[model samples]
Target: MVDVNSLAALLPDGVVVTDPDILGGYRQDRAQDPEAGTPAALVRPANTEQVATVVRWAHERGVAIVPRGAGTGLSGGATAQDGALLLSTERMRDISVDPVTRTAVAQPGLLNAEVKAAVAEHGLWYPPDPSSFEICSIGGNAATNAGGLCCVKYGVTTDYVLGMEVVLADGTVVRLGGPRLKDSAGLSLTKLFVGSEGTLGIITELTLRLLPAQPPQSTVVASFATLEAACDAILAITGRLRPSMLEFMDSVAINAVEDQLRMGLDREAAALLVARSDAPGEHAGLEVAEIAALCEKAGATEVFATDDPAEGEAFTVARRVAIPALERKGPLLLEDVGVPLPKLGELVTGIAGIARRREVLVSVIAHAGDGNTHPLIVYNPADADESARAQQAFGEIMDLAIALGGTITGEHGVGRLKKAWLPNQVGPDVMALTRLIKSALDPQGILNPGAVL
Candidate 1:
């Protein structure tokens, strides 16, 4: 067994926690992998130096370290391992927003929402909004290169990340990039660690690029009698104008969300599309009007357009709550597969076919504008057969995505859960390059062992 007493002696009194009950909470992230292991101890560091100290200690002792943020990751990126040091960055919450440069140098532990709010106070916005932004950490966002609704128009986390302060595997802290908007300096190494999922190094601080607050948005909610019609509308809308947000939900996801929100969603529709336009001034309304027209041409059963922010936000909330709403039925095997825009319809239909063939209830929700989808496969873990089928369908979905010229995961990182399929997606050459980079940075393989690799 690992010596917890020695680790305790190096940090503050309460920094190293070995209490079984407390460690239990840190075992798994939102993915809730059944294979999650019991951690030897949990370390909470308040500053970069404290983090480096913990890493140095662990490196010397040859103890594997798992760097974690708020643990809201949906890909099991932060799952704990047996006899490993669980390094929690929760206590490293600190931020300094530079209004002049429109950049914020924030510690990894700050929640994504907290970063947005802090920047908003200075009339700026940080727009890489994962669905769990309110609960996920900025460090975790950077770690996973998370994407969200606004990403259809804005961009992913890597786009907003100007620079960061990361700790190498051997406890060496190095600063990469900065508040500068344009810097072609030195191999773009800052971005290399952004989505490394802790296999490269531990991110202690992030310098995030920000923008001025968003403009008023116009919303469009359309319901289709068939999934094909919805896809047609998606193609039509994207082929024409750039929408601020374009999201889709199939019959299963629509009913599931409606069951929870009771917001008078169209239950009879086979699919729902909630889109928005954040163009300046009256142009927002014009954009929504054109989108509504496209929905009609695509055989929409009903169409609703709104310029009121409150009304639009309500629809957005319903889309965001889809995963939780579906979880009410049973445990979920979530799949984040994405394809090229033109191939999206084929991907969605293929997933439905997989669900039917596997005899499982798979709900499809997506950032349709970008062709990234989340297929939620519901199953009862107590039922061995059903669980096995769910697992099979999960792999099949990734396979289908790969065949469709897409990725196994879009915004979510290739954590422990998705690592198996990653080799199939990126092929042998890319995988070898990845290993070379990982080895050069973490030769001991002590940082987040068994993850991404």
Candidate 2:
């Protein structure tokens, strides 16, 4: 076992925690991987310098380090390894917004919602919003290149990341890019680290570009008698105009959400679509009306349009809460698979077939505008047979995505859980190039060992 006495002595008191109970809490992230291992110690650094100090110590001792933010990652990217030091950025909350430049420099520990609120104070907005914005850390968003309801319009975390401060594997701190909107100097190292999932380096701070406050949005909620009709509506809406948000929930997800929210959702509908338009001025209403018409033309069972923000948000909440609502049934093997918009219907149907073959209950919800679907496979862990079937269905879903020229992961990084399918998706050549880059940056392989590459 690597002794952490010298490491603890270098940092401020209480920054290094070694209690077994506390270490257990950091074993696994939201992925809840059954094989996650306990960490040696948990380190909560308050600033970049402290982080560097910890990394420097680990680098010299050849100790493995796992960087984590908020422990809300769904890909097991932050899952701790036995005898590895778990570095949590929860204590690094700090942010400064520059209204003049329309940017914000934020520490990795700040929650995504907090960044939005902070920037909103200056009449600016940070657009990348994962569904777990309320609980997920801004650093994690950047690390995973996370996307959400608005991503189909504004783009993902990498879009707004103008620059960042990262600690390389050797403990060298490098600042790439900046508040400048346009910088052509040097390689795009900043973009390289945005979704590297802590394998290359640990992000300390992010220079995020901001946008002006969003205009009031008009929302459209439609229920379909069949999943195919809902997919048609999604394709129609996207083909017509860009929406601020376009979400889909299958009947399993709809019923699950309705069970929790009691919002009078159509329990029998095969699928539900919630779309929004934030077009300036009265155009928002016009766009929503058009979307409603398209839904009706696509044979929606029922269509509802509302200009009320509260009513619209309620439906969006229903779509967002589908995972938790389904979790109430049993443990879930969550899959984030995405295909081209043209192939989304096939992907969704293919997933349904996998669930049927495995004899497991699968609830699917998605940012349909972007063709990214989250299929939640529910299983009774206590039942060995059921759990085995669920695992089989999980792999089958990824295999299906790859066969359809889709990705195994859309927003979530390919952590330990999804690394097996990565090679098949990217092919051996791209995989070799990835390894070359990983070795060049982290020759010792101490950073996020066993992830991605």
Candidate 3:
């Protein structure tokens, strides 16, 4: 075992804490892994040097180190291990925005929304907005390659990641990629680490690309009598122009939101779709009208169009709040499975079939335009049988996604909860390559062991 006292000595005072209560707090992330282990200590590193010191010490001692940011991970990505150290970047919260370069060099601890609001002050935008953006860290976003509602149009975290200062497993500090967007040199090492989920390295600072603030958006909210109609509207919307955002929620999700927000959502409707167009000037209104028409042509029960920004924002907020709102029903086993556009309807219907067959409640909310669905499986943990069925439904949903040529996880990292399905999705050859890289970079597997690979 490593000496916790010696580890504390390497960092500044108060950087390391071994308090039982504090350590208890670091035990589990949002996934609430029941088997989460008690960490021996928590190391709060404010800078790369301190992170390097911790990693070097851990590597030398063969101690497992779990890299955590904000501790807001939805998966078991940041769960502490027995006698392991939780190396948190919560104290590393510094951001420098360069409007001229259209980039922000941000410390890993900064929240996604904070980054978005920070860049917006300079009339720029950092596009990735996870539902937990208000709470989740930028580092966590990079670790998971998080996708959001707008990702259907703007792309995910990897797209805006221009560069990063990463602390490798053995404590070697290496800079990958940079401000210049057109760097084609060397193997795409930076891209590899973008979604490595802290198993391979600890990302300290990120150099992120930014775009101009989104233009005023027009909103379209459509209610469908059947799932097929809503899915067809989704396909039609995508077949034409690219909207800034397109979100979907099934009847259960609609009713859940309505129950919580009293937003006058249609309870009888089988599905609801919210589409937005951020085109400049009158174009946004025109595009929204087109989208509304598409929804109507696809047999929408009702189509509501609005040019009022506040009205549009209210609907967007309701969409973003779907996960939290749905939580009121029961605990959620959120699945982020994505399929090709054409296969999305099949995937959604297949999830419904699984829920019925397994006799579990699965409320689906999705970034429909991108074909990424967050199938929130609700179950009463108190009932052992129901919980087991819920767990079965969870795996079955991912299996269905894989069989349809889709992904098990579109944004959220494999973490510990989904690691079992990873090899099944990526195949042995890719898994071997992943292991090779993990071995080459983290020889002892000390950096977030038991995650990703």
The TM-score values for the models, in the order shown, are 0.99, 0.99, 0.98
Kindly list the per-residue Cα lDDT of model 1 for residues 1-453, writing each as its tens digit. Answer: 888787688778899998999999999999998889998999998998988988888888889999999998888999999999999999999999999999999999999999999999999999898888899999999999999998889999999999999999999999999999999987999989989999988999999999999998989999999999999999999999899999999999899998999999999999999999999987887899999999999999999999999999999999999999999999998888999999999999999999999999999999999999999999999999999999999999999999999999998888999999999999999999999999999999999999999
Off by over 4 Å in 1: none
**Which candidate do you rate higher for lDDT, 2 or 3?**
2
Candidate 3 residues lying further than 4 Å off, grouped into runs, are: none
Candidate 2 wrongly placed segments (more than 4 Å): none
Candidate number that wins on TM-score, 1 or 3: 1
- Backbone clashes in model 3, listed as residue pairs: none
Clashing pairs in 1: none
- For candidate 3, the C-alpha RMSD (Å) to the true structure equals 1.0
RMSD for each of the candidates: 0.7, 0.7, 1.0
Candidate with better TM-score, 2 vs 3: 2
Write the residue-wise lDDT of candidate 2 on 216-237 in tens digits.
8889999999999999999999
Task: Give the per-residue lDDT digits (tens) of candidate 3, residues 1-453.
Answer: 446999998889999999999899989998888879988899999999999999899888899999888887877999999999998988999999999989999999999999998999999999998888899999999999998989989999999999999998888999999998799999999999999999888999999999988888889999999999999999999999899999999999898888888989999999999999999888887898899999999999999999899999999988988888888888888789999999999999999999999999999899999999999999999999999999999999999999999998999889999999988899999999989989888787888888887
